[model samples]
Target: MSIFKTKSFWLATGMTLACSVAGVLLAKLPYVNLIGALVLALLLGIAMQVFPQQVRQTAQPGMAFISNKFLRLGIILLGFRLNLVTLARAGVKTILVAIIGVAGTICLTYWLSKKFGAEDELATLTACGCGICGAAAVMGVSPQIETNDEERKRENEVLAVAVVCVMGTVFTLLEIGLKPVLGLSAPQFGIVAGGSLHEIAHAVAAGGAFGESSLDNALIMKLSRVLLLAPVALIIGYWYQRKFVRRSVAQHQPTPKKLPIPWFLAGFILTSVLGTFLPLSAVVLDSFVQAAYIFLGMAMAALGISVNFRVIFQRGGAVFGAATISSACLLTYMVMMAKWFF
Candidate 1:
């Protein structure tokens, strides 16, 4: 039977949609925008774990479909949010800072996570979330990591996102408080915020706290880091496939027939290029971006439903520790870079 004919699939999909819509609505409440729809949806889904086993069983397939398929589609549409032209206008100094910051953070965070006893896949997801665009980065690179246990993979992804979100919120507050004492110019603070914060929203909030110039610089620096997602995803995919292929050979299992194709990533890159060159109106672009966020929220809700809170509690310590330390280091590095370059 076709997937569309499956009642359980439709039921699960409806649950995700309902949760996502609720998230979006909650975000519209005064000051609730700070939490954002994605995280809200994730929380709602996590709350669903208390539902009856029969209900969970019925929703499992559709939840998996939404988590994987909706996620990729959201990421593909997210490409439209990037305007290379705008990033270029932010200048070479901004670009360099973003590159160095992302690369350094990823390396540092991964090493710290490993030292804290996190597994390889968990460590990698945590690193990507810190170094790139937070939850989106984690979700984007997660599919590349070959894991026989789907639950384990989703759990890692959720843990990584939670760490990033918590760290990002803490740093956002820190940046705001420190801005008055740091005595840096608006643009300098913007660079620091954009380069260090885990999520784009975090950067925006921190940057906006200073001034308009800070917000602009922050967004440019943040989006510049976002632009690197494609290349990073490709590289990780290659490395993971090779590692898994070798493991399979050693165990006398059949190797994968072909290299994995990241069609979603390719679509992202293509969409970005077109958005940069095309004469699209701001309203149209913004609409597409909003749609992407909704889709991502739905995916997050689906992923959250599969997570066991007890498991998260057990593993949270090392992951959170790695993220906090790495975030602090990244903040210091960004401050130094801003003072020296901006």
Candidate 2:
């Protein structure tokens, strides 16, 4: 039987299986769960690429749903893992550091995007998404921007996934390999990993690898950063609208649609808060959260496979520049905070 005939089912099955095996393997390793997930995701993508037609026809829609809707739900579920009381305990200073770090990274990445002349929408998406919360940020902002051309929108989506997958993995590797080699303390590694990694899963994985203390610290720091997504999205939308209006006036065209706020973000915050008070069993909570994470990993792997490797290579410079600036700035801020506070 032809694989393309049952593409979606098989594709989902393949990714789900791959992520499960990868997750298990990583969990067993000492301080390497996050690194394992990242590596497995890339390998899965490469495997899909080698069987392009089979993956394209079978997994495309399933992957789309995962990347779009399921990814957002996963992010919201992640909020449950966060402890609001702990966040409060971290106090105003840590919150301030997180805000400053996120804002500064976004600004730096935006500047780098302009410097590189990267595609406007893609660059803005990367800056906000990668700087804030990876896939969740991208989904939150997708509705605000108007990309009338279906092909262009698809290209942008692919590019967004590619950037997230590649950078998320690389950041995980750095968290595992570099922090210890540099003699970073548990708290230091937590701050660095929490601030610098692109996705919550990767951050959690890195922190878990570091140990229990690092895991707790990193999750809190990462959640604080995730909260910045809404404000950053609003800022980007405003900037884009102003630029669009100016260009429209110059060309005598009508203004674009007003940007919509993402309701999922509000839901995420509320659910996280609610989770704090509910006192749910740890087994139940962990089960749901782990399922969501695995789904996200599968989605990311499928999305990464869809990207044309050559195009990624061609635009490698832009992606590299954004990744380097964002990662470096985040690491620098963490180092500064460690010195000042820890």
Model 2 agreement with the true structure over 1-342: per-residue lDDT tens digits: 543456675666566458545754665566555444534554565566666586466677666555556556655675666667877888888788888887877777767877887877777777776778776566566655666664455455556646765687787876688775767798778877787787776788888777888887788888888877767766766777788888888999997766556666676677678777887888877876676566556655655655555655666478557767777677767867865675
Give per-model TM-scores: 0.96, 0.78
- Give the per-residue lDDT of model 1 (tens digit) for 187-220: 9999899999988888888888778999998998
RMSD of 1: 1.5
TM-score of 1: 0.96
Error of 1 at 209 (Å): 1.5
Q: After superposition, how far is residue 211 of candidate 2 from its true place, in Å?
A: 4.1
- Alpha-carbon lDDT, every model: 0.87, 0.68
Count of steric clashes across candidates, in order = 0, 3
Query: Would you give me the overall lDDT of model 2?
Result: 0.68
Where model 2 places Cα greater than 4 Å from the true spot, the runs are 1-32, 36-46, 50-55, 58-66, 135-143, 150-185, 201-211, 242-254
Off by over 4 Å in 1: 29-31
